[model samples]
Target: MAKIGINIATGSLQQEEMIVGIDLGTTNSLVAIIHPESKKPVALKEHNSSSLVPSIIHFGEDGAVSVGETARNYLVNDPANTIFSAKRLMGKSYDDIRKNASFFTYKVIDDNSDSLVKVQVGDKFYSPIELSAFILKELKTRAEHILKTPVSKAVITVPAYFNDAQRQATRDAGKLAGLDVLRIINEPTAASLAYGLGIHKEDEKTIAVYDLGGGTFDISILRISNGIFEVMSTNGDTYLGGDDFDHAIVMKWIREHGIDATQVEQDKMLLQQLRLKAEEAKRHLGQKDVFIDHVGKYQLQITTSEFEKLIDPLVKKTLEASERALKDAGLTTADIDDVVMVGGSTRVNLVKKEVARFFGKPLHASLNPDEVVALGAAVQAEILAGNNKDFLLLDITPLSLGIETMGGLMDVLIPRNSKIPTRIARQYTTQKDGQSGIKISVYQGERDLVKDNRKLAAFNLTGIPSMPAGLPKVELTFLINADGILVVKAKELRSGVEQAIEVKPQYGLTDEEVESMLMESIVHAKEDIAIRSLVEAQTEASQMIDTTVAFINKNREYLEEAEIAATTNAIDQLNQSIATGTKDEIQARIEALNELSRPYAERVMDLAIAKAMKGKKI
Candidate 1:
C-alpha cells in the first residue's frame, strides 16, 4: 500500500511560501503574519523571543554588527558605535538636521550642503538607509526563524506624513535587506485595518488615528469607503513622543534630588541609567497611583497626578495637532466615527482620558496599541497573497513605473503594487543653466538604473522658455486609468508648454516574465542600490564643481587673491575625489569645498545687497 508521505519539518508546506507584514518603526520594529490555523493576524514570536525588536544597531571593533536587544546593551558603553533614532535622518540633508545634531551622541557629518546626511563611526560612514537596512535585516531573520519558513515578501508600514523621498528611502532599505517589499502602507491605515474598519465592501467610516510612539507622534484623519482608505490629512511633531515624557520625569527627579543636570549630561552611563529608570517609573505609574525608586543617593518619587501634570503640555500639543488635522480635512470632531489609539504611550491613563474627552467618545483601545499596526499590515499581506478573498484587493501595477533623471537614475513615480486607477504628479526643474527642453523617458522595473529597466517610451517636452537652472517649474503627471493604461503628461507651468503620451504599461509582458523580472530585481537589489548611491554622489560632486566655477568666474573682482587660491584648491580636490574616491571620500571633499566657499559667497551676496540699497530711501 502506498502510504501518504509526511514531511516532519513544515507539515507538507514548502519554504518561501509566506509573506509577512513589517512595522519598520523609529524606536522599534516587529513582524506579523496571518496564522495558518486561526485565520487571524498575529505577530510572529517564539517562547524565548519577543514580538518587538528595539530598533538599535551596534558595531564592534572587529566591524561585526549586532541588532535588537543585544545591540541595545551598547547604548552607554559604546554610544558612539551604537546607533538609534536613525529614522529621523531618513531623506534629510545636513541643513535639515543641523539644529538637532546635538541630540545624537555619534558624529553626524555636517557637509553644509543639500546632499543627504551621513553618520560617522570611527573611519566608516553610514547613511540612514544603510543603518535602517541593518535593523530590517534583523527583523527579517527573526521572522524567518520564528516561522520556520523563508520570508521574502512583505507589506511595510510608514508614517502617513512621510514625504515621497522618505517613503522611497524606506523601500530602498527593505530592498537592501533582501525583501521584496510588496506594498508601502501608512501606519494609520494599517491601524484601521487591524480594527476591521475597511474589510467590508459597504462599510463607510471616518476615523482618527493617534499614534504616539517612543520617539515620534502623528495624528492622521482617514476616510474609508467601500474597502478603500484615503488619508485626508496628517499633522504631528516628529521629534515629540513618549521619550519626552520620560525626560520630564528625569528632570523632576534631578530637581528633587538636587543633582547637577550638567553632571548627568557628562556621564553617558549615568544618563542612560536614569533614562531607563524614568521609563520604568512611567510604566509603573500607568497601573498605580504612584511610583518610587532610588538611584544612588537620588530618590525618585512621583504620583500619577504629578506625572499627568508633567505631560499635560505635551498632550495638549497632540490635541493641537489633531485639531489642525481635522481643520485640514474640513471636518469637525463630530464627523469622526471612531478614534483609534496606537503606540505604547497611548496606554497611559492621561492620554486615554484626554483623547476620549476631546473626541467626545470612548477610544478604541481594545487592540494592543503597540502591535496594532503590525497586525493590520499582516492582514494586508494576507490580502495581497490572495488568502483573504472576502476583502477587495485592488488591481496593482505589475512593475515600478518611473522616469529617468540626472545620472541615469530611475526616479520612481509609481511604485510596484500600487492600487490601480491612481494619479500622481511631481515638480521638476532644469539641471543646466538656461535649459529650454526636458527629456522624459518612462521605464518599468525595480532596478535603480534606467538602463537596467525596460524603457516604455520616450518624449521631449520642447518649447520651454529658456530659464536658469532651478527656475522653470515643470509638472509631470502620471495617471493610470481603470484598464491599466498609463498616460504620461508634462507641463512647464511658466511657459504653458504641454506634452503627453499614452502607453499600455503591460504591453508584451507575460505573467511568467513579469514574475521573472521581479525575482531578478530582488536577487540583485543590493548591488543595484549601491551603484545608485555611487552615481548620485558623482552627480552631486559634478553639480557642486560647476556651481563653484560659475561663482568664481562671476565674482572674480570680489575675491581676495588668497581666498580665490584656497577655494580653487578645494574645488580641485573635490573634482579629483569624484574621479576615484568612495562616496564618503567624495562627500568629505565636497564638505571641504563648501566650507571654503560659504563665507565668500555670503560676503559677495551682502555686497550686492548693499550696493542695491546705496542710493535708495528707507
Candidate 2:
C-alpha cells in the first residue's frame, strides 16, 4: 500500500510510503510521523513509554552499544566510552577537531586516514557518523514499532550553515541506515514551518530564527510570500551550543576547586560528572534562581548567578551572531518582524531577556523551543508526501560556491544566497605553449586563500593539443542544485571539446569508504543476532536441565523411565545446539527441544510457585 514517488513538478519526492521527518539534532534526534487518519504529527516513542529518547550512545565491554536514554545513564559511570554531543563533529575535518580538542571529552584520532574523531568506547573506536547512526537506528526502531510497519523514507533537517560536504555526509548517513532521504531541509526553515508563519505564501516579512542547540548555532533570515519561503542569508558557528555553556560553568567550578583549568581531560570521568551536574544546574536555573550543591565523586557548589556570569561571554557571542544575521539580511534590528527562538538552550531566562533587549521586540514564545524544528520538518515531510495542500518552501545555498584560479585564488561562480537550482559558467585558457593538459580546482567558502576554505573537488582537463599560451579557451560551467550539491562541466570554446568534471570533496569520506562501512555494519548486525541467539539458547538449555532435575526428584515415584529419558534427551539436544557453530541454527533447535519437553518445564514452574506461596502462608 506504501510506495516511493517523486513530484514531477518540484523535482523532489512527491510522496513516500513512509514519509517521516527527522530532526537529527546535536543534543538529541527525533523521528515523527504524520497520522494519515488524524492528519496530525506524532513523534514516535519507545513501546510502553512516553519519554523521548536521548541522543547518547554508550559502548560497553564486549562491543555492546546502548543508545538513547540508557546510554545517557551509562555516561554517569563511564565517561571514556560514552559519546555525547557528537553532532558537533559532523562534517568537520580532523584538523577542525584538533583546533577545538580542548573542549571535548573524547579524543580525536588524527593518525587515521583523513583524520577521524574516534570515540574510545570501551576498547573500540567509532566515527561520529557511526554514533549518530546508532541514535538514528534507535529512533527508526521506535517508529517502526509504533506504526507496525517498516519506515524507509524520511526528510532530514540540518543546520542552515552546513556546507556541501556536510550535507552530503548527512545523506550518506541516511543511506547507511537504509533510508531514502527525500530531502535535507535547513533546521531554521523547519522552525519557521512550525510557527505556521504566513511567509510561505510571500508576505515580504523578514523573520529570523535564533537557533542555539546542544552543539551548533544557526541564524537564518527568510523572505516569505505566496507560499515560497526563501532564505535571504545565514551565518553561525557549527561548534557553538549549550554544551559550551555547560563547559563554562564547569570551568568556573574547576577554578573554585583549585584545579588547573587545562587539566580537565586528564581525569575525564570527574570532569564528565561535573559537566553533567553543570548541565542540570543550568536547566534548573532556567526555572528558579537558587543554586544547588552538586556533589559528585568530588564536592562542588555553584550558584545560579555565578553560573550566568561564567556563561555571560558565550551569550555575548551569540548576540553578535544575531547582529551578523541581521546585517547579512541587509536589515537593522527594527526590520525583524518577529524573532522566533528555537533550541533548548533558548530556554534560559537570561537568553530570552537578552534577545528581547537586543531586538527591542517581544520574543515569540509560541513555538516549542525544543521541538519546533522537528515539527517543521514534519510539515515539510507532509508537503513532500503530497498531503499538504497549503504551500511549498524553497531554500538557498548558504555560502559562495566557486572554483580555484591562478596563484591559488578563488573565482566565485555562484555567489552565496542564490536561489535554488542555479547555474554559472566561466572560461579557462591554455597557460603555456604546447600545453597538453589543464586542471580545475573547485572550492567553497568566503575565504581569500584557497587553503583556508573547503575544497569541493578537482578534476584534470587533459588532452589539449600543443598550443600557444592563452590560445585555448575552455568554458567551465558550475551548477548547484536545490539541495546545494554541485556539478561542474568544461567545454573548449573554439573546438567544442567538452567533458564533465568529477570533483571529489577535499575532506569528505569517499564512496568506497561508505560502502566498506556499510558492509561492516551488516556483518556486525549478523554477528549480534548470532550471539544473542546463542545466549538465549544456552539460558533455555540450563533452565530445562534444572527443571527436569527438580521434576524427576519431586515425582520420582510416579515418573516413568520413558518420560525421564525423553526430558533428558531434549535437554542434551539443546545443549549440543548451543555448542555448535551457528547459534541461530542451534536456537531454532532449542525451540523445538523446548516444545518436546514443555510439560516437564511448566510443571516445575507451577510447583516452584506453589512452594513459594506455601512458605508465605506459613
TM-score of each: 0.94, 0.62
Q: What is the TM-score of candidate 2?
A: 0.62
lDDT by residue for model 1 (41-132), tens = 88877775668999899999998999999999998888899999898899899999988998887889876676788898877778899999
Off-target runs (Cα >4 Å) in candidate 1 are: 1-16, 609-618
lDDT of model number 1: 0.89
